[model samples]
Target: MSATVADEGTAPAGTRTEAVQALRVPVSRSYRFELVKLVSQWRIRLLMLVCWLVPGLFVAAVSLQSTLPTDTLFGRWMHASGWAGPLVVLGFAGSWALPLLTSVVAGDVFAAEDRLGTWRHLLVAVRSPRRIFAAKALAGLTVILAMVAGLVASSAVGGLLSVGDQPLVGLDGHPLASSDAAGHVLLAWLCVLAPTLALAGIGLLGSVVLGRSPIGLLLPALLAVAMQLAQMLPLPVALRLALPGYAFIAWNGLFAAPAQLGELLIAVAVSLAWAVAATVSAYLLFVRRDFTNATDDGLGRRALWVGLLPPVGLLALGFGAVAAAAPSTTGSGITQAKVERSVATSFAHLYRLQTEQLHRPAVTEAQLRTTATCDRSDGQVDPTGPGNDWRCVVTWHLPGAAAPGNAVYQLDVASDGRIEADGDGPKEVNGYFLVRSAHADAPNPLWQFDGDVELLPTSPKG
Candidate 1:
């Protein structure tokens, strides 16, 4: 009787409960379980396989086509240099592929549980909503990272192997050695991580809020398309800068002579802002969600209304910030002097390349003493902001020539500071569409080339 009483006293209240909690699975195990679940899905396996193989296949297709896809940023150089392939693909992927890649898995992860009516079972087994959310998010992120890795790696290797390893031409027309180009390519890919994560965050929020697999999977891509369209519109420069979509192409600055960090920095900021807001909102909703009604239609109407706050807030916040900052940024828009300097600099470098390709005497950028004057075709009074109808006349002195030579180029300048110039000329000089190089006929780098100008406030001297 004494022993029995002593044992009963030692076994305090909730002793069995404590043991049960201890025996419950940790978050790490849950994360692994989520990963296994993802891998088992046929769609996820297909996505991974596509990511690994598409780049190489695309490279091969490019090689086979008689005409290059010059519409893309680096498309014209894809066959001539291996470094261009990955860049062209990057340009394409940023618009739609990246958003779809992120949303497919993330948007479906949570909603799939709801779709299959497994939420109750999962919660009972996991015992903590926080743990389940963390595990699912972590799993989705891991899959995203893997997909990104597979695409980048495959693209790099495919470009180098399929297109012979040749020197990459910088936006300034200066040649980049293979090693240096490799580094820039890697950094450019690294710069995209934050933007992709932001999209993933958006997808996660959609999954939790919509509680439907199809809608969740589609929300991110649809949002991406809408943002892209917004960017194409004639929005204010400050407003456009605030959108995370621009970050997709901001990596172009990395290839500039003096890497343009201003826009790239803005991109990082906006992307992180979106990512944090979306992710935090999703987390709050997921934890507070009522899973008692685990059926597909069980998510309450109130939660749906609350779930909309993040996106609406984000847009209002972005627009409000830009509107607030607009007054201070009025004078900082793109100017004629900036365009003149950029065109002069790019033309000088590209002219040198043309000369070398044609077996003419070599000339340096300094030796060219290039200068440019530009005006808008629309006869706009300002003629300073982004427009597609800009025209420029570039003049330069050649070695042993008494008089200076001039070339005319039509410029289409984008809101994001990218300038594409097409030369108009009498074929003898820098105007030929194609040039005969020592190896073979190649697209003339001087005929049509791209350049970038900084979007920051113009200095007094500029």
Candidate 2:
């Protein structure tokens, strides 16, 4: 039997086994062709341009500024993330621009075929609706990913160049160690891509349902705006779950101190689920729908409008509810003044203790006018009150043991009664001072001291 099988294998080339072996062929390399088509599209090129250029321009302008407040949370975040500022700027954009950018590509992908009446030609040439659907979907995903990459890279480079490599300080007013912050910034950038994919899927679904490039493009953008509006409502948790724009805000947790992974995971899962559903719906509809020509069916148009209007109406209702429920702030200024007064009173007591501790007998109350402005020989005068002069100014002279001149001691009090001092002689303590008010209605003692004081060159001279 073995010898007979061997003989059959070695049989003439025209035999069935030999013919079967020869029939096997390699799979067609259509994915590469699809990618080429995607890359060649003008819309894809425009996305790439915006991703790179917009970030670069914004970073360049910011970098040229003579000063940037290092104290602010956002400013510190920008400084630490380096070029990530422009990319972070995308969070602001994703609220609108990203949705529009995504829609531009997604909405046009399938709708363009219907508009140009090329659906029939593509279907016949491709010979597989499944492959055609996958190609278009992948092309849209590829464009989005490419734009994300460009935006991240450009923003990183631009920020690093424009803003120096500073350690990131977090929103909670704590510093992020350099290595830790860089990783977080990169991860945050990547996390944003998840929602972008979901946005793309929405646009693709719109394209499939609308069968017109204009509607497909505008639909996703409009939906994003609608979702944003809806998110403002005190809606049921389940209803909020249905909206996509919520994921963008959820991304901010990536920069949190403990790093909110649970919210991020939920966002990722929700976005992925939405993407899958939209892609599946688009695929099934594109494959089954009759697209013999560019002409729109009334039924298809009605479906598109019906699908679009519900979300829009919900959003409008949400906006109305929010507008009506917003708090009135007409009396806020008076409320703010009362709060400020409470703070001021609490700060006065601590200032009195600090001033009494620094006093010297050589620094006479008359020469050391706790109220007079001390004109340093260097031309710097210590102002005495909070209104740019000094909140509380205390001046005293230090008598020198061996020197011809007495050293000056000047303490300028801020409106908050925090004391700052600068002088010719060494002071034991320097920098900001804190004060607590002894009582609510009691006068601030530090406020009683004059701005100027003179110390005797010697105690005998005084």
Candidate 3:
């Protein structure tokens, strides 16, 4: 019953032929073979180790700091709650770390065989190019999943141990207890997997066509950086939503009260489509390559130079197509209506913060009954585009006030749905850059407030 390869080799000629035939039977076990090879690599082992260690080191560094990274979401609360640390790390990792890590193994998985001069022998052992490609892709995906797991586990444990479990402050300025914050963090991490898989597909395609480990590893990572840069510019909302990179920031929607789902839904759909298209393209190219002549010098210098053009050309073409389809007047998706909703909500929240500092009666966002009217460029143009010239008057009904009070805020709205608002205020209420508290002068929560609106229109909620 135990038929080893050695036993088959020692069998009679008829039995040896039968054993060979049996081995050729379509048994897809190449996944195991690829996994073994992948795990044995020093780089992969090191990557896993880094994933586990980096969070602890990062938490320790943050714990020793006096100031917070306020620019990053949840950064301002890192000292106030342990739960905030992981969210800050998640933001940083999505912007820079995750894309590069995804490229490392995915970009090299197939090309490494070409470098080792093992293609022919591998072909003989597997007997199916399709199986080999499938195996490699699956193994690469497995490694990505593993890396994400290690990071989430390490980050949560490190933050909890270093800072202790406390309530987290949401992007909407509401507090989330540790129990609910844990769920939101976990979901946010899960949302990251979609775009990350899309990046892996790009890396795999690079590995298949370029046959150079360095080029494969670097190209996807470079593209990710380029996307980040593009996000900062005034691009069309439809185009930005089509990009997989936007999904990284889309996770922030989960932490907002009355969670913004429009952008998140679009991001998941676009990212998955990219993953499927890239993977299929890579598979077709891999199966059709002439392995007999496939030396370590995969594409010649000229071909290698040519290989770089596709990714660039595809990016350009995609942008052009999306831009053409979007309306010139309403492309940015930042309308006066959406801005008014966001401004009113943000003012209500910051007003409560100011009230707390003054030791006045506590106010709830709902009880404030806040509303905003915004205009663009003094109403010279349509109040629907992103610009620094938007001005808003926010009115709120506070308890015991005979008439509603209003405050002016100058807003700089970005194409990416972020709004930077400065209170041009009655100093007694909105205060200046700093407000004196019992302890010391703290940054005025009312002076400058930041908020993000969903690109796609959704029903406004308090």
Q: Backbone clashes in each candidate structure, one number apiece?
A: 0, 23, 0
For candidate 2, write residues 184-279 as lDDT tens digits.
Answer: 777876776777777787788788887764767787788788877765543433344345555675655555444546445655666675666667
Question: What are the C-alpha RMSDs, in order, of all predicted structures?
Answer: 3.9, 17.3, 4.9
Residue 380, candidate 1: Cα error in Å is 5.6
Q: Cα lDDT of model 3 overall?
A: 0.79
Full ranking by TM-score: 1, 3, 2
lDDT of 2: 0.53
Per-prediction TM-score to the true structure, in the order listed = 0.91, 0.58, 0.83
Lowest lDDT sum, 10 consecutive residues, model 3, at 321-330
Q: Tell me how far candidate 2 lies from the true structure as C-alpha RMSD in angstroms.
A: 17.3
Clashing pairs in 3: none
lDDT string, candidate 1, 1-462, tens digits: 356446555777687456556757899999999999999999999999998999778876785677888777877777778888888878877887789988898888888887788987888678898999999999999999998888788787788887778888887677789889888888888888878988999888889888874777798898889888876666666676677777897888888888887778878788888888888888898888778864643255776676677667776677577657554343335788889989998888888878877788888888899999899984665768788889998999988999999888889888767888988874665578888766889678878888887766657645
lDDT score, candidate 3, position 213? 55
State each model's CA lDDT, in order. Answer: 0.81, 0.53, 0.79
**Given candidate 3, what's the lDDT at residue 456?**
66
